[model samples]
Target: MSGARAIVEALEREKVEYIFGMPGGATLPFYDALWDSKVKHVLVRHEQLGAHMADAYGRVARRAGVCTGTSGPGATNLVTGIATAFADSSPVVAITGQVAKAMTGRNGFQETDVVGVLTPVTKYTVQPLSAAEIPSAIRKGFYIAETGRPGPVLIDIPKDVQQEEVEMTFPESIQIRGYSPNYPVDVQDIERAADMLARAERPVLFGGGGIRIADAASQFTAIAELLMAPVITTLQGKGTFPEDHPLSLGPIGMHGRAEANRIVQECDLLLAVGVRFSDRSTGNFHEFAPEAKIIHVDTDPTEFNKNKLVDLSVLGDANRALTLLYDALLRRLAKRDENNAWLKHVNQVREELKGIPAYRDSYAELSGPKIVKLMRSILPPEAILTTGVGRHQMWCEIHYKVLRPRTWITSTGLGTMGFGLPAAIGAKLAAPNVPVVDFDGDGSFVMTEQALATAVEERIPVVSIIINDRSLGMVEQWQRLMYNRRFVGIRFQNIPDFVKLAQAYGVQGRLVGSLQEFGDALREGIRSDQPSVVEVPVSHEEDVFPFMPPGKGIKDTVYGTSKEMAVF
Candidate 1:
């Protein structure tokens, strides 16, 4: 069979239901093979969106999402999307076409070194030398992408190799020497962590994206409850735990939950699970968890002392580590005293933060949180929400309480704009029965608004809720707070009519001016069963509050007009 045919067969063997990409000259052979294959191809408007779609699919489906693009600019365009996946550890298999093997290093037409270009942004990159190596490369790409710390993997196939005829049989199993993502946790380490938690007066659980990646949400909850600790998730870990639960403090860090920040500050012992403690999350590492003895658990050992040094480091899978910790704690709890006062104090702080004057508005203008709340009421509970990075993303994180794992997807570490629409398309494709909404800012949405055409054409019905403030809200807020409100290049003088833009792409569009209009539009869009855009004109003057000034600790949170709000 031909190499392209073998590639398609390998994708089928992997049970890839959808392959998002666009056809180009170098990839025509692969597209030809796809014509007879059962794997559905979604032709995106741009290669970047194709990659973003695959990233979301991988996150939602808990499998390696596959995306394809041709050589040269086609491959280069996928760089940002692949990097976004890498930053957030989303598993994706990115396949790019290359020049014929014979034309190597000859500056052939549309030739570019895809593997070299993508090496930094991918978990692994391979340029298959021959058609015979295609199957193993593809299998290894998927394996490397989905194992350990999940990340994007790139495979560049030469054009000649695709057309090369070879005797190919899908390998039953493929192995890479000395590559292992999973490791056993030391039983002694688990016992030590359990003992620490058992004796702690104030304990907190810090969860990260790895919890969701490991499918350890239940185990994490068990451990948190076993210790009676307040739980604070990182931005990437927002939906990994039940936010509405009393023990939950939501996300922590800069632009994190006020209660979560407070809990972290006061805790004496922190069980850090699957978290890297990024600088953004721990502003000024010296001041972060000063009083806490952290017991860190992660699959990657490199992450142990890379950020904040912990008293104990258990290197293992999040699920297994958390499960073992829970059991160990149960065994060690006989002499422990109830931390009821700590829980009550944390709950009081949570309530006080909810009532803080900074995060609340007088309902003078349509706010992002209010819009998120209205949309939440209109959309089904099981709907998957994807968001572009900005004030709108913050609002979704703050107001949109995700009830299940994988229901909330966002560009966390990379904080990439224009991630929403494409990701929403992928999420909807991954779970057709579940509704998907892309919460986007006007500035962020415009970056890849072109993806709407793909959504409409492919029949990927996703509702894009554009919080149209006619400005880059997040940057504007930052300038307002940190830079004397000198909004340079932050304000949008000319705003496109998003409804008209959606209509141009054959998508249903609605312009919502008021809260009522927003709700009505959301209901209408959700019922349309078609790709649509609901443009909500939020107030440009409104800012995402409870802001933590740069270089300052979370305790120094500021609100409207740079007024410092005292965090308990």
Candidate 2:
């Protein structure tokens, strides 16, 4: 059988249901082989969108999503998408076609070093020298991409190799000599951490994306209840704990809930689970959790002292560590003091923040945060929400109530701009029964607005709520605050009407002029059986607040104008 056939057979063995990609010269043979296979192929408008689609699929499906691109420019186009997946620890297997192996170093047509280009952004990069190695490479790619710290794996297959015939023998299991993913929890570490939690006067639980990746939301919730600590989720960890829960303090970091930030400031002990303590999460890091003793639990050993130092470190899978810690804490309950005082304080903070209005009295105008809050009130409980990186992303993180894990999706680390629309398509494909919505800023949406055509063609009914601010909203806010409002390339004079653009792509479109219009449009978009875009013209000057000033501590956050008038 041909190498292309062998590749398809290996994918079939892996039970790959879909492959999102674009077709080109070097990949013709592989596409031909795919024609005879059961694996459904989703042709994307761009290679980058294909990668984003695969990344979202991986995050939602809990499996390695597959994406393909042609050589040279096509491979390079997949770079940003792969980096985004790598940064967020999403499992994706990206395959890129290459020029013939015999054309080595000659700079053959459409030739590029796919392996070299993708090495920094991928868990593994392989270029099989022969068709015989294709099966092993493909198998190992999937395994590596999904196991341990999940990430993208790049497999560069040359054109000749795809055309070559080889006696195929698929490996049932792979053993990479130096690769080991499983890590057992240290009981002593858990005991020490539990003891710290038990003795603390004010303890807070900090959860990150790792908890969701480990599928340990239940265990995390149990631990939170056992400690009776107020839980604060990182941006990537938003849905791991129900936002409406009594103990939930919502996200704590830059642009996080004011109450959550204040509670973290007052906590005496912080039990950080699977959180890497990114700068955005920690503010200035030096002053973050200054009053607290932090017990950090994570799978990666290198993350131990990479950011903030910890009083104790538990190195293992989030699920295993959380399970053990929960069990250990239950045993130590008799000796531990009750957390009534801390619970009362947490409740007070929550009530105070609730009374301190999130919006101004003049918010009759349509704005991102108001839209996000409206969606939270209207969106189905099981609906999956995705966001492009910007002010709108922060608005969703702050105002959107995420009730379950894997239901909230966004680019947390890389903060890719054009991630929302395509990612929403991938999320919808992964779970067709659930409603999907993408909260996108105007600047971010236009970068990959072409993806709407793909959704229309594929019949994916994802709603895109575009906050049309006519500027790079986040950067404009930063420039206004830090650079004396000297905005350079921030404003757009004449832009394509997003509603008209969507209509041109055969998508249902709506222009929202008021709050009532927005609600009507959103409901219509949600109920529609086809892809739709809702463009909301918002104030270009509106800012996402509870803003932590650049290079400042979390406690030094600026409440912005009109916020000072807020009362509790």
Candidate 3:
């Protein structure tokens, strides 16, 4: 058998259903092998979109999504998507074709050191010197990407290696010298954490992406309910806890709900699970949770003291730690403490600021928050949503109600602008029965608008809700507030009509001016059998509020047009 055949056989053994990629010279042999395999090949318009698709697929399916690109430029193009996956801890296996082995160091056409370029962004990077190593490298890549702190892994196979004839022997079980994904949870740490919670008057449960990544949402929720603590999530942690639950305070951080931020600051004990406490989540590390004693539980030991210092740390998988914590806490506490003054106070604060940055009538002119709220009303609870990073993404973060885990997919950690459209495609592929929508800003959408071709060609029926603000909304907002409204190179003068562009790509397109029109368009798009694009023209002056400026604490959140309106 040929090396390419061996690779395909290995992928079949791994049960890889789909491989998102583009074809090129170095990958021709692999593609030939793929043609006769059970694995489906999704040819994308660009390598970057292919990578994003794989990332989203991995995130939604809870498996290692595979993506391939040829050599040099093709491999480099996958960088942004791969980095996005790495940042969010999404499990993805990127297979890039390398130049022939003999072309080493000669700067041959399409020859590049993809392993060196991707090492920083990947959990593991391997370039097999022989075809015999292909199966092991692929098996190990999938294992590494899908285990522990899940992330992307890169496997670069040279052209000669793919063409070389070799017998394939897929490894049933393999071990790496220093690679260990799971750590045993110390019962003493859980006991200490339970003690802290038992004595605490004000306890807050903070959940991050790890909960969803570990498939431990149920465990986290049980712990939160057992302690009757207010639940706050990070951007990547949005869907782990049901947003509409009574105890749910929604996401916290720079653009988080004002109530959540206020509660985090006032809490006495913060039980942070599967969270790394990123700078965005902790506005100012010095002032964040000053009064709270934080007990951090995470799988990665390196994240212990990387950001905000914790009173206690537990090194183990989120599922294991949370499960044990719940069991331990159950033994200590009999029932929810309804008479606790701290719980009453937390509820009072939540009620007081429930209307912060008030929502406009659905009939009024379209705004980011209003649009998202309307979409929520129209779409089913199970519908998945992806977003491009900007003011619009913030709005979705604020208003979109995620009822279940793995439903809210966005570029949270990296804040990649062009992530939405392709992500919607991948998400739809992962969950064909559920509706998938891409809530993207005009600026962000245009960056990867070419993805429409792939969606149309592939018959993916995801809807794209483009917030056409006619400018880089977030940048303009920053300029308006901090730079005296001196906007430069942000506004669009003569841009391509997004509706027309969508139509050109064989997608259903609608240009909506009013809220009713938008709702109509959205409904039509969701019901359509093919991909659709709904372009909504919004004012560039509209900004995402409850804004925390750089170098400021959560207490300094700007609620409305003025700082005086921050506190109600």
Candidate 4:
């Protein structure tokens, strides 16, 4: 009846199927207990990877993903991953083993005050003093992390507390003083929101991560079509509605399509669902959609006033609020607005951009758009798309549009590398029936390449498509165009033969030479039903266009890549 065993038993009773993390000194007890537990432990090469895996797992599972770390450095290592979850509203529970209680205030080894440092990132944090409270704290952590606008929660367990024996009974439900996940929606509010949508000359539907979390994709599509409104998404909102849909306007903020941003600016009425007004997606707040009369629906009320002013606020679950609003609109016999003039204007803007960021072919080599298209063709509709940070992630966000909500996962906030592979594994485990693809750059892959061993040992089926160019491609692109091409130390050399390296880890590997070869290679990986790696030989000279220079807003974006390809 040790504390570690009690905690493990509680986790089992709660049916937490997976836990992602690395082992460190203070966390030895939990690791020892993990060995004897039935829950699957995904051993990531780094704590950062562990957090990313948990974040991705949360997105796919529609539940709180769990991760573990040791005291001090171990806990701190997970900061980036946790921050990503926080920014993106990906639910995750981060468990860290702390130094013994007696040494807590004495500056003991590996004694970093994690709860203090992580306050800004986590939805809630608990440092349980008694083993008896461990289960309660865990239950509370999950409830807090997964409810409302989801984010990561932290639980700090002292080494001694972990070893102490106590009766363990995790509560099935929790009640916090200031926390109430289920909110009441007034009928009048829904009426007002409907009126706002119906009275508009030109309306736009702006969706975010919340749309996916609320499982309102169909609702979103229906609302957009019924109201005859244009739809745009934040980065995390890609694929919330099928990109091919006529009403869909790709990602709409900075680095977003020029037309999408313009549409956001011009729309008279904006129905924002399950999304925050992120700076990247809104440009400068002052000039952002000043004309739009916005109806904001979100689980978090605090977010209402954080950005664009809300003309009407509906505080409720996005799915429920949207359903009610849809019904209300229909009940009122509302007539959809004739926004054809606005739509035509937006389409004109889209046509003006030589490359609409759609699947297009112009250059000799495959473009980022082409890469995502080929990948979509290979993977099933339900496959999970994971990515490392940088322009590559943006490319996928712009192009890959197959899956449903929770299907696309990444380290959005921290933009951490070494994240994609480990996260792909977590995703595969959560949705074994679906293919898990990690779209990453060579620099991103190398940051946590050791994850190949985890794939080897666990026999987890995942396909890693490395957009290898052997450079911090994103930064390199920025420096080249904005900083006089003093490439500096951006270039990398002596990289491994990823295919052979996969063999070392007991997994299948292939190096693709061209688009045709890449197509075949991706097909084999998607069909093989086994863990594998595919290295795509992209041009080191290749760069993502439509580049928005660092510090410059979306308006300052390069119309296309070649335009920004500065030669020193």
Candidate 5:
């Protein structure tokens, strides 16, 4: 069999349903092999979009999503998407075509050291020297990508190698020296953690992306309820626990809920599970959860004490660790403490914070928060929601309710703009029966608007709710608060109407001016058989509040634009 055929066979063995990419000179043989394979190929308009699609697929399916690109520019274009996956710990397998092995160092046309370029953003990168190495390389790539701290893995195959013939035999199991995904949780660690929780007067359960990545949402919820603790999620951890639950405090960090920030700060113990304690989450490291004794649990040992020092650290998969901890806590406790003063105090704070004035938009008709609330009301609880990074994304985070895990996807760690549209398409493909929507800003949408072409061509019917603010909203907000509102290139002259652009790509388009019109458009898009875009124009002056200025602690949160904007 040819090496390219062997690669397809390996993908089949791994049960890869789809491979997203566009063909280039070096990838012809691979594409030719793919023609006869069961693995569906999604031809993206750009390599970056393909990478983002693959990333979202991995997030939704809980497996290694595959993407391919040719040498040089094709591979480089995938960098941002691959980095986004790495930052958020999404499992993705990226295959790029390389020049013939002989021309590697001579800088042949379209040749690039993709392995060197992608090493930092991938868990592993391999270049099969010969056709015989293809099968094992692919198996290891998938294993590394989907195991431990799930991340992207790259496979760079030379054109000559792809054309070479070999007798392929795929290995069922692989063992890489100095690499292990499994970590057994110590009984003593669980017991110690349980004891700490039991003795604490006030405790907060902090969950991150790892919970969803490990499929441990149920275990996380069990532990939270067992302890009668307040649950605060990081941005990446959204939807891991039901937002409507009484114990849920929503997301915490810079744009976190005011009540959540207050509660976390006051808590005596913070049980941080599968979280990295990034700077965005911990405003000023010294001031964050200052009074709390934090117990950090993660599979990656390197993450231990990398950000904030913890009282105890447990190294194990999130599901296994959380399961054991829940069992230990259950065995140790007799009954729920209905009269716990800490719980009552937390509830009181939550209610008190509710009385804080809601952000009043100058243009109430097209308010971001109100629009997001309307979306929540219209979309089913199980619908998958994706967002582009900007003021709009933050608004969705604040107002949109995600009831289940894997239903909410976004570029949290990397904060990549233009991620929503392609991600929504990828998510829709991953879950064909589930409804998918992208809450995108105009600036972000324009960056990857070409994706609508792919959606139309592929017959992926996802709704894109473009929050057309006519500016780079987030950057403009920062300029207003920190740079004296002297905006430079933030605003955009309304050229190329989004509704028309959507129509140009053969997608259903709707221009909504009022809230009712917006609702009607959204519902229409959701019910449509083809890809649709609902363009919602809003004021550029609109800003996402409950803002934590850089270098400030959560206690210094700005609840609205009415509050004094701190110049950091």
Candidate 6:
């Protein structure tokens, strides 16, 4: 078989049904082979979007997201998406077409040292030296991405390599030096951790995107249920705990829920599983959970004891570590200090949390959380939702009833501005039977709204709910709350009507003024067989509660509906 055909066959053997990418000169042979292959090639408007789709699809399906790009600008554009996936530990396989081997490193046309460019962001990166290595390279990429701490991996295929004929034999197994996916934590360590938790009066469960990546929400739920503790999911960790559950403190961080961040701060013991403590989640590190004894469990050793000093650093799969911990805890007698007082106090604090940012009745137009709740009610349980960065994303994080893991996919680590729409397109394609919706801020969408055409051409139906506030609402909120009404370069002035924007892409678009209109528009978008946009114009005055100012702790948040209004 030809090298190109062999590549396609390898992809097929790896169970890759879709490839998100752009055509490039060096990649002509691969595209030609893909022309008749069973694997569908989704031509994205930008290579960046292709990467985003791959990342989103990987997260949603719990498999590797496959994306391709050309040598120079195409490969460069894919960096952010790759970084996002890498940061969140999502499994993605990035295939790039490099210049011919003979022309490498001599300023070859469209050659940009893809391996070097992608190294920092990928778990592994390689440019195959020969056609015979292509199959192995592909297999290694998939294996590295899905096992242990999943992350993006890159394979750069030289133009000459793609043209060389080669035999195709899938690898029976894969091995990488200095890479181990499984870590068995010591039994004594588990017992010691259990003892610490059993002794603590204020214990909290904190989680991150790794929870979803591991597909271990049930294990997390088991721990919480057994301990009767509230959960504070990181922004990336949203949906690990049902947002509406009594123990759920929607996502704690810079813009976390009041009760959640507060509880995390007040806790005596915090068992953070598969969660890297990002600065955004912890806010100012100095003030972060000063009193909590943090037990950190992660697959990556680099993450161990890297952030807050860990009282216990268990190196293993998050699900497995959690399972061990729960089993050990269950085997031991229940702690005598089990009081529902703290739990009840936390629940009451959630109910009466001051500063629950509600808009003035004069501007009765729905706000972010309000719109998110309405949108959630309209979506099916199976329907997946994607998001871009900004206030809208935070609102959805707080209120969206993400019932299960992988239901929410967004750029949590990189905080990329233009990730939502493409991710929705990717999510929709990966699961064509389910409806995919992307709630984007006007500011965030305008950054990569060009992908709408890709969504249209691909027939990937994504309900894009544009929260049009006419400004970067998050920055504006910060300006209002912290900067003393000094709204600087944070406003989006004179934006186009998103409905008409969708129409120009030959896709459907609608605008909503009130709750009734919002419901009707979302209903139509979800039911529509084609791509559509629902522009829900939200009030600029809207704010997400439990906001920790810069240089403040997670506990230093302002509640949405605070009576005193100053203290979090």
Model 4 ranges with Cα > 4 A deviation: 334-341, 348-362, 548-555, 561-568
Model 4 lDDT tens row, 201-246? 7889998888898888888888887877888888888878877787
Model 3: ten consecutive residues of lowest lDDT: 355-364
lDDT of each: 0.87, 0.89, 0.90, 0.81, 0.90, 0.84
> Whose lDDT is higher: candidate 4's or candidate 5's?
5
Residue 434 lDDT in model 6? 83
Candidate 2, residues 220-248, lDDT tens digits: the string is 99888777778998999998999998788
Q: Any residue pairs clashing in model 5, and if so which? A: none
Off by over 4 Å in 5: 359-363, 563-568
Q: What does candidate 5's lDDT look like per residue over 1-568, in tens digits?
A: 8889989999999999999999999999999999889999998999999999999999999899999999999999999999999999999999999999888899889988999999998999999989999999999999999999999999999999999998888999988997898988887988899899888889999999889988899999988887888999998898989999989999888888878888999999999988999888888899999999999889999999998999999889989988998888878885466468988999999888775544343446887898998899999989999999999999887778789999999999999999999999999999999889999999889889999999999999999998988889999999998999899998887557887898899988898989999999888888888999998888888788788888799878888775534321
**Which portions of model 2 miss their true places by more than 4 Å?**
334-339, 355-362, 562-568
Colliding pairs, model 1: none
User: Model 1: residues >4 Å from true position, as ranges?
Assistant: 334-339, 563-568
- lDDT (10s digit) by residue, model 1, range 1-568: 8889989999999999999999898898999999989999998889999999999999999999999899999999999999999999999999999998889899989999988888998999988878999998898889899999999999999988999999996787777777987688899999998899988989999989999999999999887766667889988898788887768888887778778887898899998888899987887787898899999999999999887889999999999988888888888774223458988888788777777765675475477888887777777768899999999888777667777789899998899999999999999988889889999999989999989988888888889999888988888887877788888998888888888888889998888778888888777776777988988887777777667776688767765443434442
Relative to the true structure, candidate 5 reaches a TM of 0.98
Clashing residue pair totals per candidate (backbone < 3 A)? 0, 0, 0, 1, 0, 10
| Every model's TM-score | 0.97, 0.97, 0.98, 0.93, 0.98, 0.94
> Candidate 2 overall Cα lDDT vs. reference?
0.89
Name the 10 consecutive residues with the lowest summed lDDT in model 6: 354-363
TM-score of model number 4:
0.93
lDDT of 3 by residue, 466-492 (tens): 999899999998999999988998999
Compared with the true structure, what per-residue lDDT tens digits does model 6 show for residues 261-378?
7778788899888788888888876677788898887878899767778788877787777888999888875533335777877877777764354322224667777778888888
| Clash count, predicted structure 2 | 0
After the best TM-score superposition of candidate 6, give how far the Cα of residue 326 lies from its true spot, in angstroms.
1.9
Candidates 5 and 6 compared by TM-score, better number: 5
